[model samples]
Target chain A: MILSILAMAFREIRRHKMRSALTTLGIVIGVGSVVALVTVGEASSAKVRADMAAMGNNLLQVFPGSARRGPVRTLARPFQEEDALAIRREVGSLALVAPLATHSGVAVAGNSNHFTNVWGTTEDYVEARGFRIGRGRVFRDSEQGVAVCVLGNTVRDKLFGDRDPIGESVRIGSLSCQVIGTLQAKGANAWGSDQDDFILMPLRTVQRRLKGSRDVNSILVSVSRESAIPRVKSQIESLMRERRKIRPGQEADFFVHDMKEVAEAMQEVTGTMTALLGTIAAVSLLVGGIGIMNIMLVSVTERTREIGIRMAIGATAGEVLLQFLMEAVVLSLLGGLGGVLFGLAASLGMSAALGLPPVFVPWIIGVAFVFAAAVGVFFGFFPARKAAMLHPIEALRHE
Target chain B: MTPLISLRKVCRVYGAGETAVWALRDVDLEIDEGDFVAIMGPSGSGKSTCMNILGCLDTPTSGTYRFRGIDVGSLDRTQRALLRRHAIGFVFQGFQLLGRTTALENVELPLIYQRVPKRERRRRAMEMLDAVGLAGREHHTPAELSGGQQQRVAIARALVTRPSLLLADEPTGNLDSARKFEILDLLLRMNRERGVTVVMVTHEPEMGEQAARRIVFRDGRVESDERLRPLEARTA
Candidate 1:
């Protein structure tokens, strides 16, 4: 019986194909935007996570001053080599600690000259900062006092093009340094800055030879276990306060920043953004359902005489109701199918254009499809009931 | 044997209190199986209302209406619909066929409601259409068919379920004089050959005279009842 009713409904819809298509357009656009936006949002979030991971895993950085204190910035006392040593020895679950000092200068190798920031640190800096040596070896401890440097991939490309720079000499602001190795290419950070644009040098070589100061601007610490970061961070903070002779309850001169926290915060922000977009799309779906209801009511009114004929021919009110309801559900389901196809195409196209990985969220598609059908049911009931309640005598009398 | 239909002092009133308009007043009627009866009256004389009651489309405000020994007034809306589905068929004025549906589909409608299998339903509907002299015109919609052909399709639809009772209200009203007798002839043939009990309401005296028995109503009351011919005489 229901099958026959559904067949009748299909015929009815096919009779006025243009009106049915126009009625379902709202649902199509609603579902399409929802699918496309959510898929793109997921892809961008994944990209952000990957970029954060590339920065460093389970890593923390300690800077010399607190940037959050006041508008007028004051430079606190810089960290010493002992501060890094204290963090490695005093803090548990320690992986690697390197005292980092940086100086921006121009490096000239033969005829080629490139402007770059030179990072002055120990051998642990490469491991702490998650850098991979693609060519030659890292400088040893004995070479810390000697003038030696490792070139980033961009610096190699700029200075030597395709030539091998290992064991070659590069002059950093009048000091000629031997290039001991070259780091692999890491494209860019989230901030759009080229990560592979800096050169790595020994800590003592840059501090004593160039700057002539024993100040370490920042300390990079990589924790062995992710779960122990909060504990290790607090321990280092207190230790730094003690070494710098700061009393308890006084404003600390240094701050410990963790990469994991930044990564989690970024994920949360993207997740919220995705939800906001989805909610706006859902509102459009509601409007689409209203459109369906409006059209269904008009259909019921227009087919009053037809409904009367069916009733006179032994159709129960329930049967009439089912016939109209089936029409609505079928219409909405078709729209949902079309929307799914449109959304998949849009998301794929956007992903390719934005250079993000294609994210296929099957559950979201399922949810959107089911919700479209539910919109039909929720919106189709009143009109169907109205059609069913029509009196056979009055309806037949209706011209 | 119990009569196929019995109405005991039936009263159908519209509205209530001082403004009440009685459509049927203290009316008593009986129709046996295989009897052809014609109900004739002017407009607002309650002939249509009487047909509606007999077709199970309306119920009396007071008194009992019994169909095949069952109290029809005691049944709910769904039960009445069930009774109509298995026992009764209706044809209306204006040849009320669905606008876009073909003759074959219209005839198959009642069988579809009865949950008949598709192949058998098609066969039966085709047989009914053939019996109505519309064999080659089964695919034509109401708009495509002539007025006489449309009325024939309505007749086929009325008989598709092989119901026990057929009620036609002004079935020939929309046809021309030539087409009118054609529909009357078909109804007379169905009644005589199949022994199907038929009750028809008509405004034309000539249409009413052709029935085996005729009853006329006026101002919600029975005006006259006359036997035009014996049922056995026509069947013979």
Candidate 2:
């Protein structure tokens, strides 16, 4: 019985092809936009996570001042190399520590000049900051305060085209330094900053030969294990407070930042954005359901005589209800299927055009299809009931 | 044998209070098996109301109606529908065949409601279409068929379920004189050959003359009842 009713519904829908297609348009657009937006958002979040991971895993940075609270008011003097050495010796959860000082300058080699950032750090900077030596070796410990430098991939490409830069000499400011190594290629960071555009030299060399100062700007720390991050962070905070002479109930002169916090914040923002877009698209689906209800009511009124004929031919009210309800469900299901195809195509187009990774989420597709069928049932009820409750005699008498 | 239908003081009232209109008032009726009865009256004389009650499509406001020893007035809506589904068939004046459906599908509607298997349903529907002289026109929709052919399809649908009682309200009202007699002859043949009890409401005296029994209604009451010679015998 249900099969016959479904067949009748299919025939009826096929009879008025244009109206049925028009009614399903809203649902198609709704599901399509929902899928596209969620897929793009997920891909973007994954990109952020990858970028963060590339920066450094389980890494933290300690800055000298609480700059976020107000203007850069210096309550404590800048860090020295001794602070990094003390943290490495005292903290049990510490893996590696590097004190860093940075300055921007122009480097000249063989009549070629390029403006690049230069960093002063120890040998531990390579491991703590997740850098690799692509060509030559890192400077020896005994080579501190000597005129030795390492070039980043971008700096190497800019200053020395395709030639080998190892054992060569470059002029930094008024000082000449010998290049000892070249770092591997590390792409852009999460904030779109180029990470491989800087040069690294020994801390004592930058202090004595370049800056003529012993102040370090920041200190980088890597934890031994991911589960020990919180304990290590608290230890660094208290150690810094004691070393900077910060008493109880007083705000410390420094702050610690974990890379995981930034990743989590970015993930949260993307999740909220996806949900907002999904809600707006869901509203369109509701509007589509309303369109179905309107057309179904009109159909019931137009087919009153047919309803009378069926009733007289021994169709129960429940049977008539099921027939009309099935029609609405079939209509919405078709729309949903079309929407899924459109959504996948749109997502693929976006990924290709925007250079984003494609993300296919199975649950989103399942949810959208199920919701479309539910919309049919919820909105189609009133019209089907109206068709069922019609009086056979009065309906037959209707002109 | 038990009567096929019995009614006692059946009254059908519409509206309320000062605007109350009695469509049927204090009416009593009985019909036996294998009887072809014609209900004849002018417009607004309650003939259609009587037909509706007999077909189990409507219930009286004040009285008892029994069909095959079952109390129709006391039955719920679903039970009444079940009774109608199994034992009653109806044909209408407008040849109320579904517009877009084929002749075979229209005939198969009752069997579909009965949950008959697909193959059996097709065979039974095809047989009924062939019996109605529409063998080659089974696949033709109502729009593609002539008026007489559409009426024939409606009659085929009515008799497809092998119903014990057939109620037709002006089955030939929309047809020309030639098509009218053709449909009337078809109904007469069903009654005489198959022993099916038929109660038909018609406005024409000639159509009334074709029945084995004639009943006339006036002002919501029966005015005359007569048993006439079978039209088949008279014509012979």
Candidate 3:
């Protein structure tokens, strides 16, 4: 019986193809936009996480200042090389720690000079920040005072133009530094800034030659496991507070920034935006449901004689209701299927065009499909009841 | 033997109080098995209301209706529908064949509502269409068929369930004189050969004269009833 009723619904819909298509347009656009927005949003979040991983896996940084106290900023004393050593010694689950000092200068190599950033750190900087030695090896840990450097991909390209600069000597400010290696290319950071545009050297090299001070600007620390980052971060924070002579419950003179938190915050932001767009799209779906209801009502009115004929031929009110309800459900379901296909194509195209990794969440698709069918049920009920409640005599008499 | 249908002092009223319009007033009727009865009256004379009550499409406001010795007035809407589904068939003056549906599909509608299996329903619908002399036109839709052919399809649909009673409302009102007699002859043949009880409402006196018994209505009351021939005369 259900099969015949379904077949009857298909026949009726096919009879008025243009009207059926127009009726379902609302549902199609509603489900389509929701699916596309969610898919693209997930892809963007995943891309941000990937960029965070590229920055460094489970990496944290300690800067020499509290974030804010009563909206009045205060600058604290800089960290020292001993602070990095202290974190490495005291913090459990510690992977590596590198005290970083930075200086900007023009390096001249055989008349090809390039203004570049120079990062002064230990050999552990390569592992702590997820950089790989592209050509030559990193400097030894014992070579703290040695005037040796590793050129970043961009700096090497500017100075040597694809030529090997492993054993080349470059003049930096007033010192002649030999390039011992070149780091691999890392495209960009999360903020769309060039990441492979700096030169790396020993911490003492920049501190003595450029700054002429023993001040360390920042300390980079990597945790062995992602689950251990919070524990290690707290340990390093307390240790820094103690080292800087800050009492308990007092505003510390240092801040520990965890990269994992940054990644999670990025995900949360994208998720919120996706939900916002999905809700707006769902409103359109409700409007589309109204469209279906309106058309179903019109259909019931127009087919009054047909309904009367069926009633006279022994169809019960329940059977009549089921027939019309099935029609509405089938219409919305078809629209949902079309929307799914349209959304997949739209998301895939948008992700490809925007250079985001395409991500399709299966559960969202299932939910959208079910929600569309539910819309049909909710909106189709009144019209079906109207059809079923019709009087056979009056309906047959309808011209 | 108990009559196949009985209506005892039935009254069907519309609206209420001073505006009340009595469609059927103090009407009493009975129809035995295999009888061909024609109910004739002018518009507003309540012949249609009588047909509706007989078909179980409407119930009287005040009196009792029985079918096969079961009290129909006590039955609910669903039970009335069940009674109609299992025992009665209807043919309308407008034919009422669903537009855009094939003749075969229109004939199979009652069987579909009866939850008949697909193959058997199709076979039975085909046999009924063949019985109605529309065997080769099964796939033609109502719009594609002529007035006579559409009426034939409607009749095939009405009888596909092989119901015990067939109620037709102005079954020939829309046809030409030539087609009119053709349809009248078909109804008479079903009554005589298959012993199916047929109650029809018609306006034309010539049409009413062919029935074994003719009942005339005026102002919601039975005015005249005459038996034109014996029941065994048509069969013999």
Q: Rate residue B12 of model 2 by lDDT.
A: 91
Which residues of candidate 1, in runs, are more than 4 Å off? A67-73, B233-236
TM-score for each model: 0.95, 0.95, 0.96
Q: What interface RMSD do all candidates show, one decimal each?
A: 0.7, 0.8, 0.8
What value does the lDDT take at residue A218 in candidate 2? 86
Each model's Cα RMSD: 2.3, 2.7, 2.0
Best by lDDT: 3
lDDT by residue for model 2 (B83-151), tens:
888899898888999888899999999999999999999999999998889999999999999999999
Docking class of 1: medium
DockQ of each: 0.77, 0.78, 0.83
For model 1, residues A33-71, the per-residue Cα lDDT tens digits are 888988898898888888887887789999987533467
Best by DockQ: 3
TM-score: the better of candidates 1 and 3: 3
Model 2: docking quality category: medium
What does candidate 1's lDDT look like per residue over B1-236, in tens digits? 89889999999999999999999998899988888999999999999999999989999999899999999999988888888888898999888899888999999999999999999999999999999999999999999999999999999999889888999999999889999999999998998887789999999999998999999999988889888887563343
